[model samples]
Target: MLELLDLLWTFFKIGLFTFGGGYAMIPLITESVVAKGWLETSQLIDFIAISESTPGPFAINIATFVGFNQAGILGSIFATLGVVLPSFIIIVIVAKAFSKFATNKFVLGFLRGVKPVVVGIIFSVAVSFILQNVFSFSFKELGDFIFKWSTIIIFIVVFAMTRIWKKIHPIFIVLVSGIMGLIIYGLIL
Candidate 1:
């Protein structure tokens, strides 16, 4: 019971304070989960990858993944509800109240300021992921960056495919990447 409540509160704070989408929320989620000893950095990275690839919203998926790992299905429920509730409530309120402030200078100014910060946060997270996953660079220790050939190969192939076949669906790319992973990691190495 206590764990469930903690999960709810932690995720609630994360959801309420996060201005951007899931990519931007990674830092907060990683910090909170790591501080609580609920997950290691690598595990969190894996969860992020899985969440981004899966069907549902990334925030919901991550919350559920963390929650389930902590306290089973009920934890997943509480975490998901906690993360989603704030957005739902805020959207409802904003929908009702926004018309009056739609043109207000203060509101407009606040939103304008937030846009760039969100982009920066997302960009930082993406760079961190690439550095860690592809180059095996550990930001914590400032370790020497080691090139991960398997990952680099996959990245290049997927990137080239996307650039060359602009019309191809994302799922096909994911499928190809998965096969490549299997071949590279499973069979070759």
Candidate 2:
């Protein structure tokens, strides 16, 4: 009961404050969930991957996943609703007022300024994820320890395959990566 309410309120606040969609919301979610001890950083990373692979908005997907992990189906419903409600209400209000502010210079200027800020926020989230998961900043000697070539090769191959093999579904790429990782791990161990 109280836990459900907490889930709803927390996700609602996240949705309300997060601008520019999922990537932009990552930092805020990390602070709220990971820093606050609601979830671990590894759990957040898994949520991110699952969210990206699922349908609908990435932010909503993530919110629902986290909520479901915490308190099952009902929690997922509440969290999803909380995450989407603000966007729905804001869109409705903006639509109703569009005529009045359609040609306002101030509005235009604000929109222009917002674009770069949103890009910056998304970029920062990407950097954080890379540092946390891919590169741990532990490379003391450049020659002694190089970047993980296997991961780099996988990335390049996947990128190339996606561009060239237009008919292949993204899920296939994910599955292949998983299999490759297992095989590599088995050989290494």
Candidate 3:
């Protein structure tokens, strides 16, 4: 009971404070979940992958996945609601007030200031994700080995394919990547 409440409150706080949506929320979610020891760092990375691949918003998907892992269906429901509630309420209020403040210079300045902060947060999140999943600095020799040309090539190819062939749904890419990884791993080891 208390655990559920804590989960709700944590997600609520995250949702309320994070702006610029899912990408911006990643750092906070990683910090809150990983630093607090609520979930393992590896699990959080898995959540990010799953969240990105699935339908719906990234943050919501993460909240649902974590909540379900921690508790059950009810936890998933509560966590999702907690995460979305702040955005919903804020949007409603902002929609009502936006017209009135449409020409306000101070408001415009505040928003402009926020954009860089949000970008910084998202960039930090991206760095963290890349470091954890793609790079390994713990063991010097192994870390050097991990940066293989094949893996780098795969990343470049996938990135280029996504940019150029925008019509390909992301799931297909994920599936193909998974198969490629499996085949490569099998051949290497």
Candidate 4:
């Protein structure tokens, strides 16, 4: 009971404070979940991957998974509700006031300020993930970095494919990358 309430409060706080959707929320989620010992960094990474692969919002998916992992189905319910409640309330408030505020300069300025912050958060998350998963650094040599050749190759291929065939869906890119991962890591060595 206490644990479930804790989950609810924590997720509620996460959802309330997090802006700019899931990618932007990664750092906050990492801090809260890791600090609470709810999930390790590796587990959080896995949760991120699973969340991306699954349907609905990534943050909500993570909340549900973490809740279920902690205290079963009821926990999942509480955590999900907690995470969503803030968004629901805010949307209601925003919807009611949007007409009045639509042309307000202060509100417009505030939103403009927020766009850069959201972009910065998303870029930070991207760089962190790239460093963790795609590159290795060497202590022996200053400014030396080791790259995973296979992963780099996959990245190049995916980038080229996406650029060349603009209509290709992201799922195809995911599938291709998965197959490449299997071949490179699973069967190569």
Best by TM-score: 1
Q: List the residue pairs that clash in candidate 4.
A: none
Candidate 4 structure quality by residue, lDDT tens digits, 72-177: 9999998998899998998888898887777899988988998899899889777766666566542323354667788788778878999999998656777787
> Tens digit of lDDT per residue, candidate 2, span 1-189?
888888888888899877676777877787776666778877877666666567777877887787888889998988788888888888888887887776789978887898798898888776655554445432223233237866666666776888899888756877776676777666763
Model 1: lDDT equals 0.86
Candidate 3 structure quality by residue, lDDT tens digits, 1-189: 887887898899889878787778766776786677778867776666676687888878888887887789988887888898898987887888787676689978888999898988788766655554555533324455257665666667777888999999867788767766777677864
Q: Where does candidate 4 stray beyond 4 Å? A: 137-144
TM-score of 2: 0.76
RMSD of 1: 2.1
Residue ranges of candidate 3 with Cα displaced over 4 Å: 138-146, 166-168
For 1-189, candidate 1 gives per-residue lDDT tens digits of 999999999999989878867777888887797789988888887666676567988889888988999999999999999899999998888897787768889988988998898898888888888888788886787999887779999999898999999998656876798899999999999
Ten residues in sequence with the least summed lDDT for candidate 3: 136-145
TM-score of 4: 0.85
TM-score, model 1 to reference? 0.87
Q: How close is candidate 3 to the true structure, as a TM-score?
A: 0.82
Query: Over 4 Å off in model 1, which ranges?
Result: 166-170
Model 3, C-alpha of 123: deviation from truth (Å): 2.3
User: Pick by lDDT: which candidate is best?
Assistant: 1
Q: By lDDT, highest first, what's the ranking?
A: 1, 4, 3, 2
Q: What's the lDDT for residue 60 in model 2? A: 74
